[model samples]
Target chain A: MTSALETADNPQDMKRIVIEPLTRVEGHGKVTLLQGSNRSIQQARLHITEFRGFEKFIQGRPYWELPVLVQRLCGICPVSHHLAAAKATDMIVGASELTPTAEKIRRLMHFGQTLQSHALHFFHLCSPDLLFGFDDDIRHRNIVGIIEDSPEIARQGVLLRKYGQEVIRITSGKRIHGTGAIPGGINKSLTQKEIRYLQGDIGQMIAWSQGALELLKKVFFEHYNYHLGFGSIESNMMSMIRADGAFELYHGGLRARDRNGESIFDHNDYRNYDQYIRESVKDWSYMKFPFISALGQENGWYRVGPLARVNNCDFFSTPLAEEARKEFIAIGDGKPVQSTLGYHWARLIELLHCAEAIAELLGDRDLVGKELRNMGNLQSSGTGVIEAPRGTLFHHYEIDELGIVTKASLIVSTTNNNQAMNESIRKVANQYLDGHRLTEALLNQVEVAIRAYDPCLSCATHAIGKMPMELNLCDDDGELIDRLEKRADGRISRTI
Target chain B: MSTDKTFRMDGKAIPFEAGETVMDAALRAGEYIPHLCHNPNFPPHGSCRVCVVDVNGKHMCSCTLEAAEHMEVDNSSDAIIDKRRTLLQMLFVEGNHTCPACEKSGDCQLQAVAYHTRMLSPHFTHFFPKRSIDPSHPDMMFYYNRCILCGLCVRVSRDVDKKSVFAISGRGIDSRLVFNSPSGKLGDSDFSATDEAAKVCPVGAILPKHVGYETPIGQRLYDNKPISVVGDTIAKNHSEKPVVIGGPHE
Candidate 1:
């Protein structure tokens, strides 16, 4: 838009610059930078503008519908919501323990989701900045740019997305909003034909995943210092871990590791999460800042997602991922990886883990077994937590006697990383922004930091092309000094 | 003449009995007319207007219009298809027919008919008219949101079950399926889950309470094939055997 990083000298002494509706992320958001007379950023905030009252709206719906209906929150990761809600409803329906077939099929679906989502975030959203310099041509700097510069990467990404979707389609029914998982168990099993279909491309997917991880490692090492220091922040890490403290995405006890890689709490049941975690809201942002309750607001803010999961877990279950994790975690030197860009590397490792997990589940005969569902004693209330691609997702529901959800509290993955994303953006702004100028490249760097968390800001409120990028530079008197508008088609307009 | 005894629907000859509606004649010929209110086992009542076909370039409800000899019916014209799609869109927006989680999702006549007509999206802004669920019935559950006011339950209950247990109240946009019971709940009425009326609902409005999703989603009657091929699978959902979870459930 502005030659990627063309200087926007504020000779007129603009007080603050605001960037609205970020490009290339799942949804739109705004960032405001307040600069002082010195060549430094005084204040920076990544404001979440949209309010998705999903928890409130979900109340009064039939609890069974929660799995299918709540997935509408985000187009990218609907399966997480589907399975999370199904898990909660499983308790309500008294299906305390799912049949082996049902649980395995669900696990297979989660792996597919993780693979596709991580692939999309890397190749489509973050690759241009990583592969091509962030300061390169403004126009050719997205998925289109990737296609022109590296078509193989683009094809790999698209096919990976399709392969993952096919896994979902077979397991859930439709790729996006499949009605596969129900209260007690899944609706159906993977037929032999379906299993064969998935097994066909999984090897390719795994190889591609390894290749991509290697590529990312090479890219990181080439710009090793800059990549490590860019937007880096030290924070607590959190995720769901297996009882044995291995990496677990589907179901596990709660775990949070401090910056020193020591446990804040481990192996605790997540049902009492409210006692450990608390959310506080700021007036400037629509998102709530969740912190570990005992640590209090100032020190309790923690990050969740791939980087957090990899850091907090003891080891990876799959051999390839375990090897990769060891190599990757060696970078931290027995400490949690606090570098923001390290998120990309962590995500690729998980993608490889998913591919391997999918291959293992394909051979399991339980997937095709007939014992699909089992019911236990009924319960009125239940909670479900799972490791979504973005982070840890929580869904809790209390249904009335008539099986209607009377209360619901949903904490989506992106929401869990809200504070971490804000912290990352603040670090980027401090490092890149000069009080005298605000450039497109500098602004993009801010987004690059937030992209690490892969926040789905549109999870609750989604608007497509309607949300074009707009920036307003306002003075101390709250009067506009200069306005820069970037339309959906990449057209930029500036008026003073 | 043969033309005097038979009519052509999209150029297929359909012989009709006296007093038979166009929908009945086509259905008897084993052809699907993509309807919501018309069932072969019951009398045709064309209040939903989803089966409006072109006859001599005039739009008419096939479920209500009497079949005439030598009549030319256009059920597959672009104009007819567009009109059906528009009517379906209206029906979709007019009521809260959430197909994804509706117990009648894959099996629902409205959803199947929409699919058969290729109604990709509900084009109009939804009138998410708030409606309450009638879960008082021990054996049956009624989700009014999934109902399109198809009148199948009402008519079947009246004509087949002889209970006259259901009726539609209000006008136009305000119309909703109402129970005959004074408390306005299905539990207060004498409508049993085994009644033909319960089996005749084309949507999720009438369902066996505890036995929902007894048939998994993919292997469902309408899952593998379109409703046009499989036809009415909901008819076979009625159970003569007792349900283990039967009895009034809170």
Candidate 2:
């Protein structure tokens, strides 16, 4: 597939600008902008600068540890990794079906994970870009600034995230790095006290989730045309759906639809994912671009995550989210919403769906049932798939006779949407480039498009404490004009 | 027999047999003393320092110190809890005891004693010393990272199992658990899953693989109740199933 940088080099006429360690997203990434004479946008490429060798490092570890071990990859979506690995290893333990209590509790945990992850992205991360204009003051364009300026908005976001975290804490053991989901089934089910604790604030969570969706709709419609056209791309979409095509997150078969919303493939088993979906490597990025096999690599490269999930599902099981999904699909006018910014819209809908699902699950008595796990003849290989808050997440593992993880392959949500994210940023760069030199605001727009995907560079370097960051603004002749450094102590100083 | 030799602990008189240590005597008298390395089944080893009791106004390891008749020994005093917390803190930082990720977590004696002594954090800066994990064993995994150097497994394998499969090599921060095999892997060692050493780790160091987190965190040993109440030896019974113990020294 042709990339933005490949579209033009024009070495002599090109003036390059780089946005290093793109801010607010999960991990470190950079956007390289190539500008030609007369400020024509030459190219834009999203490069994942961090090395990801989690799959390689995890081999030979016991299979039981995979659910707890692999989750250290991303602090933001640890539960997604935890659950997906548990699901895959479930088959290895020979449990094709979990007990009712275990399945319900697992679903509750997944929904909670979706609720919190989506809220963090929509409210804390991307909301700054959407609520404040892309050109907002650099210092004030963040969740902290929102807390100071829009305290109510910030409070709701914090509370929403907290509610989801509480659900996770109660269902699983802790909020993060939980050991609730074990092979074959869950380790434990919810108790009466845990059930009551979760139910107490669940009503407020549902209301806040609905309000968040409404808030997104209002912001989206205020600049309807700009939001619709900004960073727009026509691409195929993919996700998992229930047997009857209802929007599903926990378990289902794969579905792929084209830009026109035509089903390219539906209900394809995730166990044979490699048979239908192929990942192609690019020399430019460490992440691979996954595409449909039938369409071939060129046209097969598609988008996943919330936008694809929203577009691919026929309807949502919950009434409120079903109404929201209808409003979302109506914007497409018969096709999938092609606007890159629509990701935020789709993400909020999922957040609402999870909230509603959490409320419904709270009333079920099975959540407090005794049966937690079942075991059968162990299998050698198994695959697990779940619609993570970001997108489709796949965890496949091959175990030895003694249940050691011989091999592991993961298609993280960020990796699945890698090509599409690059395309989105490229579109944003060109649209905002115009006939002027690159500004910090323009650089932010490119980052905003990438933020919509909420990519998690799994093996990101900044897992520990603060690191020094330097922002360099260069002149037309490639001379450094200004330098701003954020020191390890978080003190920002201009060195120019 | 009714007037058996005894030592006054707190306000109660703890009876003891001849050659019985304070820990053994107290446990035999239905008195609880928080300990990590000292088990009833194993001969007394004073390495953990968690069972420190104030005898005649001096801190001493109760497990190694012999019980004497009418001896005034204070257990669970304010000073003792403070020292145990500090000792636990050192043990916590000396090695990686990530209870959140550890399979032994709630069941581990170190964590349970930390909870009992209110050792909320590893007070000192973490040594984060280079440690290793040997996953070569099919049914067992040896995580030297979580090893507290208590010598329970070492003593159990040597004294009980009669195999001496595990031994603590080196000293101080450089100390590490080494297998008896030439390859230094448990899979090659004479250590069987049924060995007493397999169930003797007081921390998450010597774990039986493929059975982790099977008994969820909250329901595991020392979850609803403190280890003082439930006792560490009950791990073999409190687990989800038999033959794969989930608690302390397992």
Candidate 3:
């Protein structure tokens, strides 16, 4: 798999391959492949084109509004931004602890978000590629296709997503852009009626989530070599862990581990993340590259989200998910799993964990407590961090004495995985494109690499829309030679 | 006799008093005609033009146009709604109206009006005009970014509060709310936390200090229901509630 291509004999000829508007992702992105003389792959990079400037525009606004304001960042994962901003604003008001009811409700809301986002990604976005094969007709490779081929599974995916959305609506007051969360605490608590409404569907949601996991495991075992080796690259892992070193999603301290399953850092406060993480800007892409501070830039890049979280944690607090984690680890021979495609497996496990956790929270009595808010004095600076479905999200703010935000910065999940994503694209380009004539199918393999990360370029850039990606290939002289564009309507056209 | 004196608004006969404007009549009848600058408590200042309605054959500000009997008013027509959306888009672009980050979001008339009109995305180019915030006042803040230049504060301060503390200066795109005080700050002006003008702002331009987010979001005035059902009267009533700090249950 690591062998260099022998197709290129002449050292002077050059060609370019371009895939414009990559399909089935969350926002706008393009992959460019530069082929050197004789079909030898020279370079490949993913470029995020959209920009919203949330960090810059958020300045001068009141710190109290950040939680609701930042929800406009990404329509798909607004809850993550809402909770992260709320947590940051909680720090701004100097509230170290919230009422028990507020804490539990927030956790429940976060878990709901994870379930919905993972379901949408696994079923709506990536499943078509897995179910129909990567090179299947692009027309029949979507949720609509799934509905035609397997109606029961497709319906289950939709219903499971609806369950998560219902949980959000009950807690946050709306499905798309709710405003229940506020600084220091949430505005309201769950009532008996709302609790009962959510409880009615939990059993069905859990069964469907478990079935989704089983289906993924079966697929992985069937295509074992492709599942283990496709777009696989070695990198460090990062996630938030509870103080007791259990799996945590909503609130916890930072942890980083090396590829050899060795701990680099254990459970450090999120407020002090600057000491361990630093973001470096690149001229090519609008997204910032974040890496570990201690390791230097070259080896500092680490992966996050489900794959990282599953690999970095010692055990999950939930029972079934913990058992699944043990089997997942066994697949890696008691070592960190480096396969990029393992992200699908890891995501299914998390879906199971979120389902179990939501059931557990629903049983807790503190979810409906009346002490819903903690009115605290406003402080000048605060930081909030949470595990967004995609990865760890950070929201930091500096307020004036009058409570207006003076400065703001956010590091979204996709931004943290920038280096690893680019590396995976390059690896795939070298492995598949070298010594072979470029085809639309071969270029799609490159996109399959990115789909594994489930990158939300919209959240990373704080922009909008259903992502349509384009891949472009150019010669050494910078002329576009081959172009593949995936239109938003799910049609693929190749121009050479 | 009442039916004889009624004027048609979107094909529904809305009865009106002798001297009331179309907006006043609509409000009293519990019908919503979207408006930004016209408040029933104050004389209509037709500057915002968000309440423009087609009367007979011509478009006019519903707040200033008297409700003539048998008049055909196109309040909910597609053409009228599209024009209102354009006007809303202009308001969004001309000033920095960040609804998501504003204190008056759910309760805000501009935001509610936009929602009522089904204005999905701000289609126009964003001007991103630079504006200043006046936090010098001890009891209130003047966030100039959210100002829509409706002059409600000016009218309320002059006619109701008897302070004449606010006025509009400049012209066209440069127009902005100015303080009557020499220092041009709310602190130097005669404005108080209790002034009627403080609660008259339709947007978040003027806000009381230290009392943000007192009401939880879901129970807030516009969270559960659309703005049209609440009508203008209820929105004004909810916006008039005094800002209370450190209250367990206001």
Interface RMSD after interface superposition, each candidate: 2.5, 2.0, 2.4
Candidate 1 lDDT over B84-201, as tens digits, reads: 8999999888778766657677777788888888899999998888887888887788887778788878876776677889999999787888899989888999989888787777
| Deviation (Å) of A43 in candidate 1 | 1.4
Error of 1 at B146 (Å): 3.0
lDDT of 3 by residue, A436-496 (tens): 7665568668877888886464222111122354566666677776666655565567756
C-alpha lDDT score of every prediction, in listed order: 0.80, 0.81, 0.81
Compute each candidate's TM-score over C-alphas: 0.90, 0.87, 0.86
The number of the candidate with the highest DockQ is: 2
Worst 10 residues of 2 chain A by lDDT: A458-467
The TM-score between candidate 1 and the true structure equals 0.90
Look at candidate 2 and tell me the lDDT of residue A479: 77
The DockQ figures for the candidates are 0.36, 0.50, 0.37
Chain B TM, every candidate: 0.89, 0.90, 0.91
lDDT per residue (tens digit) for residues A1-496 in model 1: 0011112255345367788766433345788777656756666777766666778887877777788888888778889998898888888888878999999999999898888888887877777778887776667767778888899998998899889998888888888888878888987898899999899999999999998899899999999999999989889999999999899999989999888988899987887888898999887677788899989887898999999999988999999999999999999987888899999999999999999999999999999998888887768998889999999999999988877788998888777888887777777877887664555566567767887787364211112112366777777667887787766665556766
Per-model TM-score (chain A alone):
0.94, 0.93, 0.93
Q: Each candidate's root-mean-square deviation in Å?
A: 5.7, 4.8, 5.7
Residue B116, model 2: Cα distance from true site in angstroms: 4.9
